[model samples]
Target: MPIPTSNGHASRVQIQEPRTRSPLPPSSSPIAFKEQQGRPPPAAQQTIAGKLSRNLFKGILFSQLTLISLLVIVLTIRGLILASSHHFHPKKWYPPLLASVAVSGVASLAWQCIFIYNPPRAVKATFWLTPILTCSVGILLVLIGSAVDAGIGAVFVLFAITQSLYGCWITPRLEYTDKILSLSTAFPPARTREVVSLSILVSVVYSGFLVTGIGGATSTRTNLDLLFVSVILISLAWTMQVLKNVQQVAISRARYVNFAHGEDMDAWGAFRVTVKHLIGSICIGSTLVPIIVLIRGSIRSVNLMSGSSDEVMYSGADCFSTIANKLITYGNRCGFVHVGTYDKGFVEASSDTWKKLRSTVGLEKLIDSDLTSSLCFLSAVSVGAVSSLTAGIWVLLIHKDYALEVTLYAFIIGYFVGRVALAWIQACVLAYYVAYSEDPQSMRFDGTIPNRIQRLQLLSARRDNRELEVGRDRDDTDNC
Candidate 1:
């Protein structure tokens, strides 16, 4: 038993060691090993507290869409009620409305800069705030028109117009390439980038419309021509936006289809096809519709100039501007819903009174297309019809009496109904696109992103929490 000392015996007997083991390949390095574990390395996970602080600052106001919507609704409702019951003068309404537009538009523009300039992690909050502030401003402007002066409100309308164009440009730029390629029906980024660039380049050209409208209004002292110019500007702005929208949507669908089929190569190919189609569509569809509208408007403009029942022409012009403002305000607020040719008549007819000229012209017959293009066609017609009808309503309900009471009641009843219907259509269309675009396999992805709205809020919350902890630690350190 004493002699059975195993460790001592083994040490004495086993003198030779086995050959040393070879190190792993570079691909199997320790850094890679940790990455395989599904977590970022410690250095990667670490971030500065300033990031959270910046996010908290940016997102404090913009995170809650519900709150923003409620605020807008409340303010709009209050203004409408006061205007209706008190019969406030046009001067009073114009000032407040202009103030709201200037303030909100400026705020939104500022926030957009924040999103671009904020610390990396803080961007979510900055981006979130932009739309809410912008929307608040826009809603105020629209409501203001009903309260006091639709003519003056036309100038402020450019804010929403510019914002939409900016969104289409920036969102596509920031978003994933795959998403852009998938959604686009044309040159995808190339065309989008061009549109954005061209808009910036031609800001002067576009601004000419505003200047002309304002100048014409001043020189002629005619509300009708002013309204006509505003209406035309709005129509052109929307047409530009929608042309880009169609390209985006087409590419999106094509990319989604390819991805869904598990054919990554095919998906890219499909995206290319989509891009081409989008270009053709924009050339064919977008340009064509607006041109027709412009031609008709031009003819009408000529007739009015030639002394065709100046009252009726001006009345129609006012009608055009009012309805255009309503549609632009509401349409921009709502998601992009293009009610094609068929829906135009429905929307036009929905108004309390009918336009004999609009009805007799039968524009639908000339521009009507199938259901796939239904949204585009409808969008053109619906925008025209809606703008015309709302203008008529404003003249009938408010301008004639110099009070907003009847207009407010009509807006409350009509606007909400229009909103609900529009919202339903938007929700359905968006849902369909989103659902259809998703791949069942992609759904299983560990890192699949959530909705844009949700993602921004979560990022903001996380950033805020981090900042609070850092602040607390800093305070404790100072105290000690």
Candidate 2:
């Protein structure tokens, strides 16, 4: 009985000892191990996604390149076959056109290579859609042109072809900018809508003025018609300049933020900056006035010399307008470069751009190459070709009566629409070049610079070497 009682006391003592003295593993150690194991799947998923995106980009690029190559081959073969049958004439215009085509093809291939080698995350659907829409509209215009009048249709076809080529060339550049900058926010639909609305308004007003001035001039042959024409020209120029400035500001800010490695900028900020600089931009834009006046005067003098014949006058006027527009465009480009580089007032920016151009060797060429005028020409050609072909097919199918009017309207509509879409890309590309020119290092992604950019930087460095050497020599001479 006494042994049994002692056993109960011993059992209690054993239970209390185990409860108090059993050692626990370090607190939350197992939980932390599980957490560490859980973390890697997310990282692994991210890695997989990145690789997939890159692969998809490369695939799209390759497919596009293949298609373009096939198109070029087909075109060349068609031209050759036509020439053999005496259907194709090697006129003065033919050689230049062929040369342009060849150059554009080469430029396109080069551009594709650059993109593939440095593949961005994704190409926006809009980039592809813009050109397609542009071409479609152009084609529609061409069909309309044929129905109305052969001459009008021909003009519409020409315009459509030019627009198509521009779309092809510019779309890629825009895609590159989007990818390079990691601009998740696609082209602002609202901004595009606004531009379209404004452009339409201006175009309508300009068209009215044109009609009125032409009729008045033809009927009255007075100074009043000329005055109306001048008003139309000035107003149209002013509106275009304003729109251009707005686009530049928006794109440049996006580029600037990207270059500085800052957080993404919103549309409102871009719009505000544009509005803030509106007056100054308008003033800077007006610098084109003197040049325009000189062009118009020269055109008038030539017309007078030609005895004011209608056909001769029209041709001369068209030629002069083209020349003047080109000059204005180049000037505007310089201004845009300055704006992108320094984000300064427009006048200051213009001066700065001029100074940079004057001071730097090969800088102009570099800018032109980076911007790729040949590519632009090619793009315009592509757009035009597609449009013309489409329109021709439609004309063949339906044989509509109002084809000429349709062609004219379509040409105008498509050109403006495509222009608006591409303008954003153009502005972004301009800003990209400016930023690169100023500081090539700032465009690094993941601490790595693109090979093309590196090559550019190397070239720029070589160009500047003489200047650096001269400075060094002068310093040594002073020391001596």
Stretches of candidate 2 off by over 4 Å are: 1-148, 155-238, 261-264, 286-334, 337-347, 354-363, 371-406, 443-450, 453-480
Give each model's clash number. 23, 17
Which is the leading candidate under lDDT?
2
- Write one digit per residue (lDDT tens) for candidate 2, span 304-407: 57644379677876776577545544454546544433344444555555554434444454454343333332333333333333333443345444233223
Cα lDDT, all candidates: 0.31, 0.41
| Lowest lDDT 10-residue stretch of candidate 2 | 36-45
lDDT of 1 by residue, 1-480 (tens): 011113211221211121322233232233322221132111212134523432442243234323433433443444444544444443433332222222222332332233123222222232333334334333434554554545323433454355445445544324422221112221111132232233222332332223222223323324664464355444434433433434333333322222222122122232234333223222233333345445555655655565443687777776665555343222221111111101111122112112211242321121121111322222222222232234334444444442232222222222211221122122222322332222212321212123433455566689999988988998999999
- Kindly report which residue stretches of model 1 are placed more than 4 angstroms away from their true locations once superposed: 1-196, 199-204, 207-210, 250-438, 447-480
